[model samples]
Target: MANLRDPVIGPVIRAEGLTKVYRSGPVEVQALRGVDFTAAAGEFVVILGPSGSGKSTFLNILGGLDTASAGRVWFRGLDLTALDDRGLTRYRRDHVGFVFQFYNLVPSLTALENVALVTEIARNPMPPAEALALVGLSARRDHFPAQLSGGEQQRVAIARAIAKRPELLFCDEPTGALDSATGIKVLEALTEVNRATGATTLVITHNAAIREIADRSLRFADGRIAEEVVNPVRKAPTEVSW
Candidate 1:
């Protein structure tokens, strides 16, 4: 079994009985119902579930994009629910990095400029060129997003996310916009960052094949954890079953 302490040897993210509900015209929809989860620093975890299974909802709550109606979230002993809007924004800006399915690169900006935009706001960010090199896009730093391929653009997005050296990285449907081949490349880039920087990484995906790359895989169903699996030996992205 993979040791829970292996990731940074300490817990970085913790959720206890997390619950979120939405009200719609006299009906209550429970997106997440009492879900408990923990992600240690430097860990690579995958969250898998079908549509409307609460995977995205879970991620959003952890990332501070949404609030839970019940339960508590503790990030290294700081109760996230206790934080106000400004505090939440500071927490996300200083400690967390987010990657979504869409690249969201500015068409008018070059790859370097796109990354620099975030670095400018970061308290202590790495140079844009250095971040691009880490993602294997140094050669294309001067090129615009429109000039790059899908996989390359995604890599740029990854670089932009990591430029600030965030403590935690959240990826939601990162490969949804790409084909099988391109998606594999994107996954490889993500894993490479996790291994190199030891950043706590959480990926929400519907693709079962991607589980092979995770230290721990969590399966969700009906707003609850259906199963949790640990990979004694996680396969490389290229070697994973697609």
Candidate 2:
């Protein structure tokens, strides 16, 4: 049976023949080389690659943080490569959420405050308390970043990311700073949000074991996607090892 989400939202993300060439003085480095990819709504995708394998480059372009040098990419038919900086900013603010390896929370702000800051500016946002509850951090919502553990801080980051109810999410090594158990908890929050919000989520990480939880996985090599793996049955984050 086809995933019900496939027909509902169609392909929320699409990339074709993407290339990124960065020039520094006389040096020209091709980060991504002719990559083509797509993700349906509510799909959980994982990307695995070593450092400098174009994983981050591709993700940055897909997330609207950077532009592609050639080809085109789209989020729900909005041509990202065609958007100017102002248009891209609007697109990001209205539709995209991001989580990085480091939780860049303000030291003086409590978790609730950190999340509330985003909700204040978002066009349509859930209450900060509800977002905290979604990440199992309702109790810690009042705690400052210094008071929270690494995993807890990351959960707060997740809460902040999803508080706006973004249609798309990009996580770049979200679990890179935590222990295995803590990482699993972070992944749990991510999966929960992806399920509840029907966001097309793309997680970029080096941990191969993490792929088990993805509906689709891409392995990038030397500035290109070398392999694609589709999971017949996705494993719950709790069941993933390493």
Candidate 3:
């Protein structure tokens, strides 16, 4: 378990004056307006915002899926802007894990196979069975996506993301597709992973109820952080309101 009382030694991720602009027709839209943020190692950070607030854009830039129009991103002191396409690909593969709203599992593959597909390429990875067990899906390891419930499939996706033991886990609306009860379970699984492995976790969500589980929460408006709050006592997912 990570020492909750330990001081944040250094930032694992830092965004300095980050900006992203999009050209739609003759109009220019700014998705991120010089956003500055930093996340410490093993910290659980939640970004809250409504649609079009640029939270997703910020996440994409941090995850290496999108490039910033201006400014820079640093991960463990490596300037992301300095990395070329190949370097960015390697950085993502080695240092980051992503969980989106949809479970992008291969329809033809069983849960175990889906996870192993990624672990096979990882430098040092947990076994498929171990990964499945971590997400409480050991019994359903052989089950195909079609055979699992919505929540079960999402758990498999979570297992797949964490099998590589990524230094950072990025989740964007991970519970958006589930019911209230199932969302709670998925959140519980995420909290368990953070507690057990000390992975730096970031979640982007519109659901305010889910914010209580994070160590820090930031509210965004019009492409910038409007407010940031640190929770003195982070609640377990099971204790959070739906």
Candidate 4:
């Protein structure tokens, strides 16, 4: 495998001529259209798009949850498109952490235990307590999902995802279900974790305001990236409003 840290090829992830098409009984929906993307290590990139714009499809393909109908993806110069099922699974398990819209915590498990579920199987992991602390939930380690607020539960989910110290983090609509204030808190936690862990972070959301907090933002429309913006200085999560 080639090294991403080499100055000549500094991107941690790269995609070329990406496309996705969903088919059913002679009907085909093109979800992505020849997309090209790259992200450097430790960079925070936000993708913004309305429904059906293909942002989610792009993320899922890159994160190994779904395969592209056509394209090639590279992670640290490893060709992801060529990976078999087991190789993809191992790649996801070892290198990626994911946060989705819902907190999928086990109802009966405490925050710490829920986090421990991942650490137990990881090759190397931080203590569950430390992961909770990273998300500002150290005091709630003993609380079950039902006992915590939605934001708190989501934080616990984040703690679980990061406990294994993955190199990349992918978040899809992470704040979609929260109110503005709670969403801000979640964004703050995400930013904190990104800074602390130096994970290459990618967030996909419909909220345009959230773009203000990222190093770069891409706007998707009609299955293509319509605009790209680089933030000279990212706004603090607290400063973002939607």
Report how far residue 42 has shifted in candidate 2, in Å. Answer: 0.3
Pairs that collide in candidate 1 are: none
Residue 116, model 1: lDDT of 96
* Tens-digit lDDT track of model 3 for 16-85: 9999999989999999999999998889999999999999999999999999999999887679988899
In terms of lDDT, the poorest run of 10 residues in model 3 is 1-10
Candidate 2 overall Cα lDDT vs. reference?
Answer: 0.92
Clash count of each predicted structure: 0, 0, 0, 0
lDDT by residue (1-242, candidate 4, tens digit) is 55433443478889999999999999999999999999988899999999999999999999999999998999886899999999999889888999999999999999999999999888779999999999999899999999999999989989998999888899999999999989998999999999999889999998999999999999999899999999999999999867
- TM-score winner between 1 and 4, please give it: 4
- What are the candidates' C-alpha RMSDs? 3.9, 3.5, 3.7, 1.7
Per-residue lDDT, model 1, residue 215, is 97
lDDT of each: 0.90, 0.92, 0.90, 0.92
What shift in Å separates residue 100 of candidate 3 from its native position after superposition? 0.5
Top candidate, metric TM-score? 4
lDDT of 1 by residue, 1-242 (tens): 34322334458999999999999999999999999999877889999999999999999989999999999997776789888999889889988899999999999999999999999999889999988888889899999988999999999999999998888899999999898899998998899999887789999998998999999999999999999999999999889777
Candidate structures ordered by lDDT, highest first: 4, 2, 1, 3
The segments of candidate 4 whose C-alpha lies over 4 angstroms from its true place after superposition are 2-9
Worst 10 residues of 4 by lDDT: 1-10
